[model samples]
Target: MVLMQAEKTAIGSICFLAGPFTLLENALVLGVIAATATLRRRPTYLFIASIALADVFASCFFTTSFLDFHLFRQSDGPTAYLFKLGGVTMAFTSSVGSLLLTALDRYLCIHQASSYKVLLTRRRALLCLLILWSVTIFISFLPLMGWRCPTGLIPPCSRLFPYVNHGYLACWTSFTLVLLTLILCAYALILLKAHRHETSMTSLQGAAGTGHARMRMDIRLARTFGLILLILVGCWLPALSFMLADVFVILTHTQQRAFAFCSTLCLVNSAVNPLLYALRCRELRVALLQLLQRLCVIGRCKKTTQDLPPGIHFTEEISCTAITEHEIPTNGTMQLHSVSEMVNN
Candidate 1:
């Protein structure tokens, strides 16, 4: 009841905040994809793109629960709503699974550059995502296997457990710990490799082109993701431990609210990934901005090109060997250009 009331008063707050959060994330992503027009050309963005979309879905999912209870009176659905089965498990599996694969993609891109082409292809990304979702689905549904639902109940969330939810207890605990450990080791390897990379470059002449920049960006991404993994673990660990302790001894209502509160912290991870990648990876930012600019041009030119039939148009969104504004000397000018080819019959 307390949680429900708190959520009610918080609707305006969530809408004001989470809505814009979703928009910027969505625009930056669709702008990239639309401007690129071809996925193969921008393979570096594949993982982030996938995760951003998944984050959007995740935000929608969790918000539904809050909105349903807070905004709608029981008389509106009261008993006939489909909201219960809509959000929770699907959102969890996709969001969490997406993060895991995001790390795996980064590992492949950084560690195995030789076959990064062959290994992290689009099909491979889709297949990995499918596998992750399949596993998440299997585990998320485990609670349903033994539990029975009480009929005519709105939301069907209450009476979800005969006792404590042992299924949830086991799944979230093991999954968070294992993923957090693996993400740590993967990032540690990236840092070690980055150290070796920097040392091997003997001169300023050697540190040229996108190679050095790419390496630095990858290292930064690894560090950011490592922090994200830590945050994921940190956010969930308290709640997880508390829940497990409930099995040993009864938990007070205060303890349950504390556990519930912890889940909201995951939203921070969902919120910030866009800013991190945009700010950290120089080439990606260039590509993204170039894409946006190209889209604006296309928008302006759409009605003017009447002589041309329905023909395909291509503008380059890929910009390699970029020196970001921060890196350039105060007196030096940063030269940035995109190589574009317009295709017409």
Candidate 2:
């Protein structure tokens, strides 16, 4: 009892401090993605946005629960655990499931390059996201709906900690393993095709222009997705393994402490996702840079309107003036120039 309580406090403290920061990061990523028209239009980023949204909610739920406990010294009651469990499961599942859809989308793009757009239309993508959320919500609330918690206990509340049900654990583990395997297989085939195409490009005559561009894009995408997969596996594998073990093998106090560690480690995935997107994605990097520029413009009042870039503002209105000049010099040479500038206070 003493060790378990200690584990919760120690682990919970770390997560409590980290939660707000994670929330901010994911929120910024989502903001950037939403603000940029180019990113929001892409089918892949649609899934990325879904993942970011899930993480944001996860951070909110987790942070709120932790604040209740840390600030007010609240007990581990049913309500608190319900919020925590719902948030964690939904976030984790959505993040992983988003990756699965992304991998499958990339595979289709590679294999059916001509028909990819026709197949995965915006409507279809939206439908997929809707289904993903529906399934995730259902699975997350199963325990609350009478799967594990016994009947006739006080005013109806289940004990906190080790919410794992053996039947649910088996089903969850199987689903996750299968989905991850599919993601791996899809990426493997993508890498293989990229390698072959790159080799063939090397042998082609005068293929440097488009061929090199395509090869670079393919290789960069593969690497980005590969990094995402690695992060996902590293973050979640320990938690999944321990969850599986808890089904058959009874864990000692030490093992339970380790489970606490694993659980926190998994939450790290949500924290690091925005960082990964910012670093690995060129489009997102550009959007982040623009966002920062806008912030800087809003902060400093000394910069002249002429110095600022076009259309960078917070709540300020940008009024543009366009003037065209046509001049005839002594040499009878005619010149025309057009200038457009935004007038700002």
Candidate number achieving the greatest lDDT relative to the actual structure: 2
Best by TM-score: 2
lDDT, candidates in the order shown: 0.56, 0.69
| Model 2 C-alpha lDDT per residue in residues 181-249, reported as the tens digit of each score | 888899888888877776776677556686767778777867877887798788878877877776666
Q: Which residue runs of candidate 1 sit more than 4 Å off their true CA positions?
A: 4-16, 38-44, 70-86, 142-164, 197-230, 246-248, 298-345
Cα miss at 67, model 1 (Å)? 3.4
Task: Please give the distance, in angstroms, between residue 303's alpha carbon in candidate 1 and its true position after superposition.
Answer: 7.8
How do the residues 1-345 of candidate 1 rate in per-residue lDDT, one tens digit apiece?
234567545653654477468657755664565556554355456656666766676567665554554355433332223334334555555665666666666777778989888877777776676777677666655545544234432222232222225445555557766775676777677777766665566343465675667677667756766676576677556755775665455556566655555555555566765665434567666767787676686665555454444564323322112334575553122212211123412
Give every collision pair in model 2: none
Q: Which regions of candidate 2 are displaced past 4 Å?
A: 1-13, 63-80, 151-164, 203-226, 295-345
